[model samples]
Target: MFNSFLKLTSICFALLLLPISIMAQELPSSSLYVVTSCYVNEGSSFLDAVEEARATIPNDDNAANMMFFRQPIAGTNFEKNQFFRVVSWNNLQHWAQPRSLPATQEYSCDNHNRTFHTTRVVGTNGNTAYTDTDVAFVSARQCMAKDGVSLSEVYDWVDTRISRGQASRQNDNTMVQMSHKILGASPNVASGRMITIRRIGDSRQGYARFFDEQFMGTRDRTLGALPDAPFEFCTDANLTESYIVHSPGRGI
Candidate 1:
């Protein structure tokens, strides 16, 4: 009986390694992110669920190279708090097919789900690699220009801001990556949506300091000059902040 148990463990370990070893070397022009938001059950501890997921999620493997986060901001969606799971993959072709679940993640949550894909617009690395303990603060903006704004004008605005920031920084510490939303689940329009990622420290206070310095600092010093909002194409928008709960491995 012990021998059979050992065999099962070995097989599972090997299976986990297979995807990592076989992962593609090059990244695609775009990636898909499936964002799931849910509330923890009344009796279940969210932290406990995080601990179990850390043990079970095979983030080092192809399937594990995704991110999980918690959206602590309140007063939205009728004040129900939620967590998020972001799954990223280069190839859309194989995403729907059955894949083996990690032996470690033994948990679940409840809520509404939304998904979107982004096309790389500007950055040193268009993909994300998350850390286990460090909580990254992410700010995503979904926007559209008003009547007279052309798509190219909005594109130039973001592209120039990123380039200017990169040029001003003496080091890459203030680095920020931005992407344009290409496809999304309803109310998540594609035209002017932008997602910005910053590696703030592990705590909420730390994130606050970093956020201030990055966005509220002296004009064009940390992050480049803020671009004027183009209200010509469309006027609707949504912006939210979330904390990283899980880190993703390097993007292929």
Candidate 2:
């Protein structure tokens, strides 16, 4: 009888471990975006603007943006150097979706009172026909298309931060918001401070919705906002961290 009891215990442990292994297969990853402040000087030439952007970009990655130029009459008086920038992040779903980052408005420095129009980019024909999405697409393709840095370079940087390894109940409450901005934002997430998630050998699938830099960690249904909020944050995963989220608000 004792021998039979031992065998039964072993069977139970295996059964429990099996589901965890299957869930582990569903880890995640995602894409995101960031808006940064860059300065353009008055009377600076177009080449000067490009050089300024090059200096500001952190790395040699060709994906780094240099900004865009625009003018009103398609004339070359003082319009060629006027432009702004947009950057991208792969697997940071909320940011990469294209609409999250707003485009820069035209401001003037050449005309003393800084008079600027709702200026648009001029082709050889001087037409303001470009949409915000058009500009975004140009920057996106520019970085990934040519001799630029690969997604792996960015991944390598993020992976180093994934050094923390602890296990906890999968909190639908936390992490969703962090995916948009940065990781381990605890003060905004759980208990209000960013911290790396612990290691987990098993995985579980669930929805993630809502993101605010201030929201972090696991929140309770009775204590905080809706746990199963009505949206999806973003989605993608890896052995170290599951960056993707499929909350049911937007991507139905």
Candidate 3:
């Protein structure tokens, strides 16, 4: 078992260094993301599960990047020992490539329950030095477009928010990503919900400072009110401890 694990790790490492060519597709402006929830088996530690999952990363050139997130058990509806793995693809055509996971004692994840998101970054603070070991705080929420509001208008609202944060000097280490569900469970597909993800800082302290500035400092008053609501996002946001398990040098 030890030897097999080492072999798998080596293969994955090699694949990680390979350059992924951007595939020719109709939607060159965005990338496809697959988010999968993983549950660690009883008696297996989260670190063990992470190592096991890392060994199974797809080697195809279509696979752009992969990230692992440890979901908080408290204040969330996730089951115990739940983690998330998000994979990025160059295009939808490459997503059709056959992939499977080998049985593992550390954890079990079902690819079928995966949610597909078509994502594009709407705002950033210009800090792009992303690495595999970098840790980040993510706040995700589901949103629905307001009546008669186009998707572009919704994105413009997001941009305006980022601009406010920038003016207040509160978004130096933040990135805002907007995603639309292309394929997923019935509820998500039927609702036509959009996902807003805010990746704050490269470490836990960054998140701490962000909140402190928002609540304790005077910056909040200067940021100004939000523009007319272009989308109605859920008030309850899902927070996660996101870790970059594998980064392909492209800034997220």
Q: What is the lDDT of residue 82 in candidate 3?
A: 83
Position 46, candidate 3: lDDT: 80
Model 1 lowest lDDT segment of ten:
231-240
Error of 2 at 191 (Å): 8.2
- Superior by TM-score: candidate 1 or candidate 3: 3
Best by lDDT: 3
Global CA lDDT computed for model 3: 0.64
- Residue ranges of candidate 1 with Cα displaced over 4 Å: 1-28, 58-64, 100-112, 119-133, 145-156, 169-175, 179-184, 188-210, 214-252
Per-model clash counts, in order, read: 14, 44, 0
What is candidate 3's CA lDDT for residue 177? 70
For candidate 3, write residues 44-120 as lDDT tens digits. Answer: 98878767656665545555565555555334678888888777776687778776646778877777798888877
lDDT of 1 by residue, 179-208 (tens): 445445446444444443333233444445
My TM-score estimates for the predictions, one after another, are 0.57, 0.27, 0.75
Q: Please name the candidate that would achieve the greatest TM-score relative to the true structure.
A: 3
Q: How far is 110's C-alpha from truth in model 3 (Å)?
A: 2.8
Across 8-117, the per-residue lDDT of candidate 2 in tens digits comes to 99999999999767644421343333323233555555445444433433332223222233212122222344442323344344233433222323222332222111
Off by over 4 Å in 3: 1-28, 58-62, 126-132, 186-191, 218-227, 248-252
Return the candidate ranking by lDDT, descending: 3, 1, 2
Query: For residue 232, what is the lDDT in candidate 3?
Result: 55
